[model samples]
Target: MKANIQYAILIAWGILSVSCKKDNYKAPSGAFSGRLVYQGQPVNVSYNDVYFELWEPGWGKSTPIVVNVSQDGSFSALLFDASYKLVIPAAQGPFRSLTDKTTNSDTILLQLSGNLTRDIEVLPYYMIRQTKFTATGRKVTATFAAEQIIKDAAAKDIERVSLYICKTQFVDGRNSVATKDMSGAAITDPAGISLQVDVPALVPEQKTVFARVGLKIAGVEDMIYSPVQEVAL
Candidate 1:
């Protein structure tokens, strides 16, 4: 009986060891990088607000790998070398998601072997252009043109334009020290728009601040934003 129990214990240990080894696979070795582009120009968006999904099929796994786009509209991910179905969920950004016809869905199929770089095109409702930021005394002013890019059945009216200023480079509606808004009704000319926000006293006292202009569509949750600009206080 003692020999039999020892033999059983050894078999169980061997089983557990093999299971652990199978589960402990190597990390992903391939990389996927790209940008969200419109006419070959990168679309600037709020950091971490926009993302895409990558689903690796044939693994009996339905969960997706979420990759967030950077402020400059670029994204990078380390993935296993396999076939992936990439898709951007509907109404997830300031722009419209492109649908893939072959899959009859919004997914774009990718066969990544080592490293791949491809820019995904999108149609934005509006593009903030010619942004200029100036700081005078305790106020920071922003001047930009809100160009309507979509003018069809999918076109949306402007909801509001905002000027956001932050002590750091991450300037947005949520991470700003000062902000100013302009209603859509007040905007007479889309080509020329101006907004000003009073800067608050920084706790650490800094001479420079980062700023950007954001354009919100009437029914859109994500606002199209301009590139970050540095201004001296």
Candidate 2:
């Protein structure tokens, strides 16, 4: 009778220990995934070692989540149940064009539930300046200006304005050049209009030189034109 009792107690202890171990273990939650594409092409973007943030509407707060974007433009993240306004820092990533002032907004929206994958597309509007090029005695110069009429929605001219220029080139039927700070290289008029330019010495042979003039405003695309004027040496 004593031996039987001891055997029963040992069996009970083993069962309890196994039950406790099973109860304490937990499984990982689901993950979210997506790809970033532009014009039907995958973009190789760099991320700044930071996780993207998702903001809840009207909550005035956000949550940080880890994100991994592969070289092929695919991305993955772990998230919980929530509707989020996603935002990545403009300083990093292949979505540099998304940071262009012409773009309406840099933030994207996402809904996460369980393990899922999605594809995201982002288009960027580039602000370009209008230009007219002229050549004289082996000296080539391009002049750029804006054509958009500056007026408020009430059709009244605004007193103050900011304008800038960008050097542009067409690449494989797409605008590939990035807009740079041309403030020092620009010629500003008294009314605060700006122009694009190219020095004579820098002009290459038979190359189509273009300039883009951009107006400063949120959601405003660049106005671009090229009027080539040639002169004989």
Please report the candidate that would top lDDT against the real structure.
1
**Relative to the unseen true structure, what is the C-alpha lDDT of residue 78 in candidate 2, on a scale of 0 to 100?**
61
Q: Which digits, one per residue and each the tens of the lDDT, describe model 2 over residues 1-233?
A: 99999999999999999999999865546577766656654443322232355566766655555465553456776666567666765534423335434335877776666776766665322112344445444333444443333343523221222222222332111332323334322435523344323323333443443432233323332221222122232
Q: Each candidate's root-mean-square deviation in Å?
A: 1.7, 13.0
Predicted structure 2: clash tally:
9
**Reference-based TM-score of each model:** 0.93, 0.35
As for candidate 1, its clashing pairs are: none
Error of 1 at 67 (Å): 1.0
Candidate 1: stretches off by over 4 Å:
101-105
The C-alpha local distance difference test score for the whole of candidate 1 amounts to: 0.90
> What's the distance in Å from true for residue 109, model 1?
1.2
**Residue 188 error, candidate 1, Å:** 0.9
**Model 1 over residues 43-128: C-alpha lDDT tens digits?**
99999999999998888987899999998899999998999999898868899976667787678999999999999989899998
TM-score of decoy 2: 0.35
Candidate 2 residue 221 C-alpha distance from true site, Å: 23
